[model samples]
Target: MTESDLTSNFPQQSGLPGEKRTDELGMRILKAAQTMFVRDGVDAVSMHKVAKTVGIGQGTLYRRYPNKGSLCMSLMQTKFDCFAEAINEYLRDAANATVFERLSRVVSSLIRFSENDLDWLKAILQSGTLKDAKANIFESPPFLFIRDTVQRLLEEAAAKRELVPLDPAFASVLITSSMTPELMFYLFDSGYTPERIAERYVETFLAPLFAGAGRI
Candidate 1:
């Protein structure tokens, strides 16, 4: 689906015209929930505390989300539009690059995602409560946010012999393997700059993968 579709479907709390009609009270509840979910784990946040935080009653919180998982899901959905835009922007910016350049940037995008959007991602990955929400095996992953864009590139890569012929999904996963911030986190905790790791990543893995890859 287009980013416009994601935007239209998952209405934000930041005053979209048709998104929810946010009165001051609803906005307060939303803001409070964002703070709570980011600050505390989803399981730890409660309806009562949400009510207290927004100066509303438990009845009011229920008016928004029937339960905590749904409430937090709503919070995540709210953030999806902005995240989609950022990813699409990066993909567009890399559009004119060579296949290898695009793949490198997509890997870079994954690492940036892990570092920038850690808390919301942690909530989604850790919480299975939202699994029934029209889910996919990969939807909950922040990487899957850009899955279509990356997957199509993989398909073309295999078609053109850019890399060894592989399943698009597997190739995409292979390209992203161990390029996470968790890997970077280890590097950082053990003291390595993001730049050094990225340079090493390209030389060690990416260059060989696409040495003479061309359009199919």
Candidate 2:
């Protein structure tokens, strides 16, 4: 199916009181599913189990989310929104900081988010919604947000003579692509902590770009 077809398949409730209740129930479903997934692992949690946890009927839950992947996408969307807001706030607060420092903080924030939501992210990737989409994940909002942020930072650094002359657009893609959930999960399985991964990622992938800038 086309990307638009996939997106449009998801339910979109309207109206006031009904919409409010639907939103509340949706939040409850997400919370219950997240708790179960984090505690029992995604493979161990069933939709029936999630419905039971949320005190909703299986049919009710199914109406909202046809499958676990759909539910996971909703959960990931919630987390991504908050993460994006936090990154925006951080950037605003650190506007005067060196470009490298801002980039480091943003990248580290992203790593922390990935580590925290690992299971949900894994389920989303495997769900086929993204895999089957015509545009794929590179065109997804979350990826675009990070890529644009990184690209803007790189451009700022270049303007300040803090970064080496390079194509910010391609460089941003290189940096953001490296932080995919698949690679992060591999690193985690390889016994690397999020902090360690973030550190090494900054040092290896980002440091050379701003080598002469000197860390503040």
Global lDDT of model 1:
0.63
Count of clashes, each model: 0, 0
The window of 10 residues in a row where model 2 has the poorest summed lDDT is 1-10
The C-alpha stretches of model 1 lying farther than 4 A from their native spots are 1-28, 35-47, 62-70, 123-135, 139-144, 159-161, 173-208, 212-216
TM-score attained by model 1: 0.60
Model 2, stretches more than 4 Å misplaced? 1-15, 38-41, 212-216
Q: In candidate 1, what are the lDDT values of residues 1-216, reduced to their tens digit?
A: 332333344433455655555555665666677767666855678789999988877887887777666665665556655666776787688777766777677666555545554555555545555457444545555556566666777776777677754577865666554554346667656766566666777777667656655332
TM-score of each: 0.60, 0.82
* C-alpha root-mean-square deviation, candidate 1: 6.4
lDDT: which candidate is best?
2
Model 2, span 1-216: residue lDDT tens? 222332333345667998778777876787777778767989899999999999989999999887888888886776677678779998999999889999999999899888987877788777765666545768888999999999999999888888877999999998898887889999999999999999999899889888866643
Candidate 1 residue-wise lDDT at 179: 57
